[model samples]
Target: MAGSTKTKAKKPTVKKPSANKAAEASHNGAAHAFAPEPGDFRRYFDSGHTHESLGITPETLLDMYRNMLLQRRFEERAAQMYGRQKIAGFLHLYIGQEAVSVGSVWGTRPDDPIITAYRDHGLALARGMSPNAGMAELYGKIDGCSRGKGGSMHFFDVDKSFYGGHGIVGGQIPVGVGMAFAMKYKETGGCCLTYFGDGAINQGAFHEAANLASLYKLPVLLIVENNEYAMGTAVHRASAEPDLYKQAYAYDMKGAIVDGMDLFEVYHAMQELADEAREGKPALVEVRTYRYRGHSMSDPQKYRTKEELEAKKDEDPILRVKKYLLDNELATIEKLDDLDESVKAEVMAAVEFAENSPVPEIETMYEDIYTQSDYPFLV
Candidate 1:
């Protein structure tokens, strides 16, 4: 790590939200649109001032904007490395969905548990994991949080309480519920944020896990990141009802639709839900977000058109946050530019560390596949 000098799972019983109840509840909310009401969401596009009008402090807005920019830059760097062939395997970049992760993660305490799908680089960074450590994982270096075996999809750090970067589509759902159950059973003041994509909504696991969480009133937040596409397949083409938040009715829990592109809106929604979960109630949040990149690094995007992509770019979450900061004079252009440069340097440092760090020793591969290890496991 001389080049940079930078810092830094599990399958459980699977459950699905009950179909009969979900179906019944889904119909009840059908009469209402999932879009947030007038005051439910705060828009930054046309606003000259933020935080004050939104009842949040200038410090909070700056903090949220900084976090979102970090995520945006982190993913951008990951994509660049993937292009250079420095990173291998599947790479799911969270380019346009920064607000969802940054905002939601900010709402949780240091001791709270957070779990999500394979797109976890941003989540890790938001939870205080360094860019150097995350990039090192992508490069398969021993210094990675997982000792380099997990790559981009499995960056687990028990000390920080990030459960994992689960590779399976909906696999983390039940695990999130179980973590919540453990917290309740052991009387720990912790909750789990289980995140997955809209594509995974149809998975039987979601229905089952959701039902259990609600029935038990476990301290968990079921976050469905409705980014409109599941691996290049649009939701309209796949889902019967694209309003993902409506599924919450089946579990008899609270549900809300948040503007995933706006950090303020996402923060407000996540804060409220986290409170509900802590009070021994389960809830669901459908973050209506969009991913600027393909489902993964290799996607050619034949499924959609450039015009549509450009249109969505107009709603860039990072830009919205930045504009809000400037308009309110919370941060000046010089400060933001300095911040951008700092992040870029941080990312470059991480890449250098990953390129220079040692790969895991060959002999170590014989260890850690099971509860008990044998030397020949590598062979």
Candidate 2:
């Protein structure tokens, strides 16, 4: 009876996609049934941009990686200092959003005015702000970019053309519009990068700024750094049309979305949009990113689960670029390590400099506050 038994059935074999590709099955599944699916998070220009197309060399790639690592290390150190109470007030650490800052900054010129919300340290540092000045500012010392007055929320460097660290949620949007209008007025042939969080995008200032930018064809790239949550609320709960880039169409402006975790995607998209903006074609770019840290040092971050954070880490922008470099054979492991070591040393030196810096004199506090005109008035 056993010898006459039927044969066993074999299991079905299915093909697997690359790490950079989402599951074809899910992507091709029912539209309403879609959920967050994984593959390559970066949506590169023309599907994927090559070094030849982007005109970048091994050194350039290495430099980008170095900047990202530097930002990461600097923030990590800043967190330690904050825990130790070296940095007072609100300390919003840009732990996972380095790519959006570094890549977008690189996509534009040094003279292109850059402005953003209070989470400003990353943007400032990426736009060539010295680590010493940045760290000193956090320490509330006189050597800080804003000279101990602005604290962690406001960092300014006129030379770098980084306008500020604006504290009022969407306030910087109007300032960016003014900057763009000036560029258009003077025919300066420059663009402005105005960045705000998903929460800030809902404010009146952002809408008004968008209208003015589009109406006058101002050279402004309005960027919404959508990191999923605004304070404690998810994006869906805040904005009706969560597709923020599409908001550009309301003002008759061009719009696009870039994966902020993908450095290549961010850089290329920013570059293209910036170039277009320089030609007086204002655009709104939604840079989808994630912040591993809480909204601020004070936040408990109970909105999301631990599994979500861990899963997102797998899409770390730094690791993404590193993998690209290694896979392409463009750089050796030692070279990358050396780059990282150099950055670490640099950040350490900045911390040392910040520690040694002196606090501003009480008398100097009232100096930048008021000025007198040459009027013949008796004291």
| Candidate closest to the true structure, highest TM-score | 2
Q: Candidate 1 at residue 329, lDDT? A: 78
TM-score of each prediction: 0.84, 0.86
Q: Candidate 1, after superposition: displacement of residue 255 in Å?
A: 1.7
Query: Taking the tens digit of each residue's C-alpha lDDT, what string does model 2 give over 242-261?
Result: 98877876777777888889
* Model 1 bad stretches (over 4 Å): 1-50, 53-56, 372-379
Model 2 scores a TM of 0.86
The alpha-carbon deviation from the true structure for residue 267 of candidate 2, after best TM-score superposition, in angstroms, is 1.1
Q: For each candidate, what is the lDDT?
A: 0.82, 0.88
Q: Tell me, what's the RMSD of every candidate? A: 15.5, 12.7
- Where does model 2 exceed 4 Å of error? 1-46, 370-379
Provide the global lDDT of candidate 2 against the true structure: 0.88
Name the top lDDT candidate: 2
